[model samples]
Structure formats: C-alpha cells, structure tokens
Target: MEKVREFIVIPQKKPETVRDLLGWHRKLLFDCLKQELKKRLIESSITELNRLIGKMVPSFEGEVLDSAAKLKLQSINELLQEAREELLVTKKVIKSFYKSNETIIAAIVKSHMGEETLTRLRDQHEDTHPNLLHEPGWMLEYQVAKEQWDKGKAAFLTFGTFMDPAKADVIVISNPLDEKIEFNLDWREIEESRE
Candidate 1:
C-alpha cells in the first residue's frame, strides 16, 4: 500500500461581512486549496482487482464461484452500498451549501458593485468557454470556494503558515470557527452548525 500525502486548510484571515473582499483574492486562495485537497484524496482503490477476478463472484465471468469468494463479494457489495448511500447524502448537503454560497457571493457583489454589475458578472459566468481559465464573471465560483476555505472548512488543508500534514498540521488558530471545528478525514465526517 502507498501512503498518500494529506494537507489540511486552516484559515489565516476571515472576513465577517465581506466588507473589503474581492473575487480575485478568493480565486487565488481557492485555487491553491483545491489543488492541495485534490492532491491528497487520490488513495488506492479496488477497481482493478475487482475487474481482474473474472468468473469469480464479483466479476463478469460466467463461472460459479466458491463459497468464500462469494462471501467476500457479498461483503464488498454491502460496503459499496453503504458508501453510495452516504455519498448521496453528502452530495445533497454540498449542493445546498454551494447554492447558498452563490447567493452570498451575489450579495457581496451587489453590495460593492451594484445589481447591474452583478447581472453582467452572472451573464459572463454563464457564457463558459472551453479554454477559459478564469471567469470574466469571477463572482460565482471563487467566492464560495474561497469562503469555504477562508472559513476553515476544507477537510484536508489547514490554514496558517503552510505546514505539511505528514507531521500533523501545526495550525495557528485564528478563526473562531476553526477553533470550534475539526476534521477526522474519514470521508464519512460531516459538519453542521447554526449560523
């Protein structure tokens, strides 16, 4: 088994009301967080092994499997079913959070730049191009992602001076939210808090 590197995000600064926040700052921070988190999550999986065992209980081979093999397959299937159920719930929660974030970013944009500017930004975001790296309408994506990272919500990366997770995150606790929250990295971990 290969040991994968893990990174956690701990916020250095958090804006309460988005008073002076800008979309580009969000973009920069969110992009860095995203890359770090993604790099951490690519652990080994069983897809190849399951596919290789043809004619076995878990494979497409039309042969009869032994009792032990059948039991192993059954166990794996049960685990997969449980994972799927959890995934559905997590997806729902994430989607809802992102939707709320869109509204929050829109509010911030309108507050700073007015409704007309917000409308134009939305239009630009909707007009996605294949090669476009950053959005002409930067308000939508970055704000939510950055806000989440800023708020110290990403499981894998910790805020503060960048420290590698191999030594356990040495986070300088700043955000009150960070002090109140923790991540177990078990993937089944979900956080809920009152606003």
Candidate 2:
C-alpha cells in the first residue's frame, strides 16, 4: 500500500504582506490545498465505483465457471459504460471545483502575500510534473516541456477532462515495450520531430 503524505507549510513569522512569500511558495500552497479538496471528491466517487466493481465481477463468473457459461458482451459493455460516465462526471466536477476555488484562493494568497507578488506569480510559468504513479508518457511530456523551457519559453497548465490532441502544439506518444513495425502515413504537418 502507498502512504499518503501531507504537508503543512507554516511561516516562521506572521506574514505582513504577500511579498514575503516567493511566487513558487504561493503556488505550492495553492496547489496543496486544491489537491486535498480534489482528493476528497475523487475518493468518494472511487469508493462507489469500487463497490459497483465488486458486485459486478461475480456476474462475470458465469462465463468461466461452467462449460456452458456464456459471454455476455452487452452486460460487460453496460458495466463499463456506466463506469465511464461516472468517471467523466467526476472529472468535470473536479475541474469545475478548481476553476471556482482558484480565484478565492488567489485572493487569500494576495491578501497574505500582496498584489504585486500575485501579479508576478500569475505571469510566471511553472513546470508540469507527474503524480506518484508516473502514468505512461508523463516523462515524455516533461521532456517536451523541458525543451521549451530551455529555450526560455513559458510552460503553462491547461486543465480539462479530455485531450485536444488535434490542437496540441506538441504531442509525445511512447511506443509499447514490445517490438512493432508499421508502414503508415501521418497526414499532419509536424515540426521538430524526434524519435
């Protein structure tokens, strides 16, 4: 099991103005608080989803238990479809939660830190990182960001429920570990291609 580590940042002295806080520090606090709220909401949805999975799994046992056990694609599809819908709604709610709370959090940060610090922080770009799981292709994305970062270009975040691959200026898709060969054509015009 993975341990959930939480951090609390306490200022040594009372903050007289927002300027006392470095821009990254303010972002860290904001991200921490926002992440916690997201965790609670996402956990609730996952708990129910897990329960549904438990109840539904036995229903599939029939296909393996008996020689005559049948495969019911409709039942399986319906189960997955429901799960997808639940997750999609959860994703939407989480994104909306961030959108709504960010402003209030920013205001609080500005009050404690100051308007100038907030302004600079908003204008600054930060690196994007992967979560603990380090989901596939994250490092690739980080690398791409780093390339842009090295050239003194800004890297910003875009929050959404789905990827707009078509509109993305950069895309990094890793091939599977297994060997593969494909004779195909990519119609899109790409720049700075890499292997």
Candidate 3:
C-alpha cells in the first residue's frame, strides 16, 4: 500500500471587482491549467503509444525477418514519428494558448483600467524600463506600446460577446479628438473583414 500526500490550499485576498477577479484567477490558476492540460495530453499520448507497442509485441515473438515483419516495423516507426509530431503540435498549441489568453486578459483589463489607471501603469512601466524612452522613433513607440497592445488589433477584433456587441466595436485613433485630423472608418471594409 502507498500513502498519497495530502494538500490544503488557503485562499488569499477576496476580489472586489472584475479586474481583481481576472487578475486573481490568472495568478492562481492559469499556469496550473496550462501545465495540467499539457500533462494530461502527454500522459494520454504516452499511454496510447505504450498500449500500441504492447499489442504489437506479441506478433514479433517468433517471427523471422520477412516483408510483413518489415512492414510492421515501418508502421511502428511511422506511429513513433506521428507521436513526435504530435508533441511538437502540442507545444505550439500551448504557446498559442499562452499568447492569446494573455492578450485577451490584457484587453479586458485595459478596458477596465481606463485612462488614469493606464497612466499609472505606464508610469510604473516607464520607471522600470527607462531604456524605452531613448529608442528611435517607431522602436521607441513600439517598445512603449507593446505591453498595452499584445496582438492588440487581433485580440480586440475577437473581443466581447455577441450578446454585448457594443463592447467589441474598438476604434483605433492616433491623435486626440481636439487635434486637427480627419478620421474615417469604412464600414464596408469592416463588414467584409469580419466575414
């Protein structure tokens, strides 16, 4: 008989707002969810491979070198190659999940943070990354904005629910409204792109 280790999880600060809830959930469970999903995927794949190899082993017990045996070996090799490919794909899926989730979460938080909160956040970021202020034109702008806009356009495009269509209508503007600048949105282009 084996004894399993018992664990107890203690809850921390309670969340007051949706932003707090999202932040807490990400901090507490996002990494765990990613790791658990990866673990389960890999475990199932290994179990399937082992079961396949086990079933195929009996056929090779007393078999002499023949075309059939060679075919079986080739098939096994193909399965192994597929498993390798699947692992690579698994990595890609996990990476995509990490990137997309971070962006979506940031978008939601950004919406909630508004101008003042973002200004404070930006101040903190600037304090930490003073080098960003010195970089050349586009690079400087990109470096400063990258944190706020992680796949910003793509994330915003898919943001919000059908039930709340208004939330999804994100408009990007460079200059302030007071600035003498003409801004136009082609509704036809937007509709075509959505399709």
Candidate 4:
C-alpha cells in the first residue's frame, strides 16, 4: 500500500441535524475512498506494466523478434487493457452502491442517533469553532454520549486521527442499534465478503 494519506474536513460549527452529521461522515469517507482508489489503481497499473516489461526484456535479448514475440506483445497489451477496464468497472460499481444505499444509510443513522440528542450535542458545541473534532469539550461530550447511549444500543458520531487507513479505523461512528448491520467501514472486509 502507498503511504497512508488523510483527507479531513473540520466544520466551522456544529451540525444542526443528524442528517447533516451523517452527511459530513459520508462525504469524508467517500473523499478518502476516492483518494485511496486513485492511488491503488495507479499502483496496480504500474505493477502490471513492470511485469510486462520484465517479460519483454528477456525475449528481446536476441535482437530479431519473431511471430511469437509479436503475439506475446499483443497478449500483454490485451492484459493491460483488461486491467484498466476492470478498474473502471470497479469504480462504477462502488459509485452505484454508494448512491443506491445513501438514503437508506442516512435513515439508519438518524434512527440510531435521534434528532434530540444531535441537537443537544450541537448546542453544547455551538461555541467551538473549526476544531470540533479536536476540541477537548467536544471529545468529552462524545465519550460521555457513547457511554450513556451506546449501553442502550444507541449510536453516536466520533472522530479519529493518525489512524491506519488499511485497518478500517477510518471512521469509527458507533452504531450499535442493529447487530446484523456492520457499520464499521472496513473496505477490505467488505470486499472479501462480497467475493
């Protein structure tokens, strides 16, 4: 994996509604995914091209290229084209999945963390500017809310920083309402399970 990169957004003020909070969460995750996806696609293409060149270099040792060499080159080009097409298809699939489930995900988040609590938390952090995620007061509030409501299987939004991107610690919004719904955004696990 490439050096883990971060894409963060700090709201100048607190979110007015649960919808707004969820929107921020979704935006952050999607932005990060796009960044990571671009990096991975490039890395994959480079790796494939390097492998092709490694094979071609040995075959070109004798100077005179034959029909077999030409066919091999054609096959290598086809493999590269296939890899590019697969990456594009993967991108489309991810976007489609995100769009299809966006509304349902928002509804689920709203239900897990009620509007009243969201409003209360927003009011509590009304004065904290820009650094809501890092503010001591907001952090304390988040922990308290998690302990209080999470015990009852409720949910709340939280922030994390300097975490491993590959380990799925990207966004740790605790949603304990439904046991079957794994809200943990582990991209690897999702892909593995899908496979």
Best by TM-score: 1
- Compute the lDDT for candidate 3: 0.42
Q: Rank the candidates by TM-score, best first.
A: 1, 4, 3, 2
Candidate 3: C-alpha RMSD after superposition: 17.6
lDDT of 1 at 191: 23
lDDT score of residue 194 within candidate 1: 14
Give a tens-digit lDDT track for model 4, residues 1-195: 123222224333334444444445545445535644664775588587769868797968978778888888777777777666666655444444333233233344345666564455445544332222334554464566457544553333332211111111222345433334423244455456456
Candidate 1's TM-score = 0.40
TM-score of each: 0.40, 0.31, 0.33, 0.35
User: Local distance difference test, per candidate?
Assistant: 0.37, 0.40, 0.42, 0.46
Global fold similarity of model 4 (TM-score):
0.35
Better of 3 and 4 by lDDT: 4
How do these models rank on lDDT, best leading? 4, 3, 2, 1
Residue 144 in model 2: lDDT: 65
Off by over 4 Å in 4: 1-46, 54-62, 109-195
Write candidate 2's Cα lDDT for 1-195 as tens digits. Answer: 223232223334323332332222334335544554565565666566567666756887745544333244445456556655655654454444334323433444354457785565555532232231134443455466457546544332222101111123232222222323221113132221321
Q: Against the true structure, what is every candidate's RMSD?
A: 14.1, 19.6, 17.6, 13.9
Model 2, CA-based lDDT:
0.40
Stretches off by above 4 angstroms in model 3 are 1-46, 58-63, 111-195
